[model samples]
Target: MPVTDCYTCDREAEFDQLPPRERIGHDSLWRVSHATGSELLGWLVLVPRRHVMEVADLTDEEAAALGRWQVRLARVFAQELGTPKTYIIELGEAPGFHLHFHVVPRPVDLDPELRGPKIFGYLGRPEPAESPARDALATRLGAALDRLNE
Candidate 1:
């Protein structure tokens, strides 16, 4: 995907302009932000600042930092949200999405029916009464990630 046409790239432009609920954490290579249309709280996304359709296209610095970002973000989610595990998925198939990783918190006892890829059903779905508010979740996670990065 071309940088100009990438949705992630457009969001990156909002680094300073977007509200906290939209922009989360980021470094030199990757920008971590809240996922749109997701009903799940702490649904963080890690996207490269530049457009790159494949993980193989990541530069050495970007690839190396990507690992650290994943580990750190996963750890923060586990620490702050008390998630037993985190699911990290990278699929660049969607139009304008480019290559991005979805870092999702998985409760220890996630329903069997919703395990694995099925968990994605929660994304873009209507809000559940049990779902936490996204703005509050983003604030907590963003602060936790900032402290972790320190």
Candidate 2:
């Protein structure tokens, strides 16, 4: 059951028309999108194709695919951008924001002050990376994901 007001559901419904950044990569059970309104370049969001509000709601296959995606995205970021670590978080607190996992790259030079949960300060901040830049990075990352899928 899809929620009419859900952000992820809204995007999922427009799968065919979504921009490259919004459909970076996907399998039958999940989709990856570049995080919008954020300065973080490689920040990606892994979302279920169907509407599910909690981890318990996920099917066994969905849960398995979710872990694989997180690992693959972390590996890609490490190989391509040399991010020492990646942060995976899920906080479905907002109204329209449904259950989605945030895979954020934590570079070696990242300010120690913004480590861990505090790194969220990078999101929703002023001066987010522009659309073209996001699209380019998404395209690059998407291609990397494609190669890995091979």
Candidate 3:
């Protein structure tokens, strides 16, 4: 079931209509999409197909699938972006926001100040990542994920 007001639920409801950048890939339990309003390329968000307000709300199956998706997305980052590390974060503090995990790529040459949790500073920047670039990476990353399943 989905919460009527949740962003994740709204997107999930339109999964079939979502663009490549919005619907990178998904399975029975989870969905993956490139983060919007962020300047950082390859910033991905992992969300449950259903509305989940808290991590504890996840069923055992959902939890397992979440771990698998996290690892797979990180692997995709390593292979596609040459990310030295990836930060996985979940903060369901905003109203109408469903639980989601942020899989942010840590660039090899990232500024020391932006390392670790500070990397979040890249989000909601003055200028968002260009759509063409995001879409291109989405296509490539989506293909990489497909290959990994082979």
Candidate 4:
């Protein structure tokens, strides 16, 4: 697919201008957090700061750092959220030219049918939730990131 304007850049811009949320944390090139309470499943999004579309666009330093950050965040989520495994996904199909990774936590007892590549099969579309819920989740995630710093 053709690359589009970077959504990560837009989000970073908005996040930087707005007051800091209690749920997010600074992890070098990206922000880390569990998904809002809407899905209590411990979903996380690792967004890059720059407006790059592919991994190839990342500098050697960024490439090396990305792996370390992913592993570290996954470890924290597993310990704090009781997740058995984490799924790191990079689907550049979206309009955002920036590269972001999805660090989805999975429980060991989770249904096999909904496991792996088919986790979101039933939830065909993103549900519309209240803004407060999102804000709350962001706050919680930000706090979690803070803990990781210590």
For model 1, the superposed segments whose C-alpha errors exceed 4 Å read 128-132
TM-score of each: 0.87, 0.94, 0.94, 0.73
What does the lDDT come to for candidate 3? 0.87
lDDT per residue (tens digit) for residues 31-137 in model 2: 99988767777788999999888888999999999999999999889888899999999988876557899999998999999999998988887646787888898
CA lDDT, candidate 3, residue 46: 92
| Of 1 and 2, the candidate ranking higher by lDDT | 2
Count of backbone clashes, every candidate in sequence: 0, 0, 0, 5
Instruction: Quickly count the clashes in candidate 1.
Output: 0
Weakest lDDT window of 10 consecutive positions for candidate 2: 125-134
Pick the lDDT winner: 2
Model 4, residue 38: what's the lDDT?
Answer: 26
Q: For candidate 4, write residues 71-102 as lDDT tens digits.
A: 87777667666788888888778654467777
lDDT digits (tens) for residues 1-150 of candidate 3: 446766778888888889888889889999889987787888889988888888998999999999999999989899988987989999778865788999998999999999888888888795456788888889999999999999
* Superposed model 4: Cα runs more than 4 Å off: 1-4, 17-23, 33-41, 94-96, 122-131
Q: Look at candidate 2 and tell me the lDDT of residue 121.
A: 89
lDDT of 1 by residue, 123-143 (tens): 879655232466667778788
Q: If the candidates were sorted by their lDDT against the true structure, best first, what order would they fall in? A: 2, 3, 1, 4
Task: Please give the lDDT score for candidate 2.
Answer: 0.88
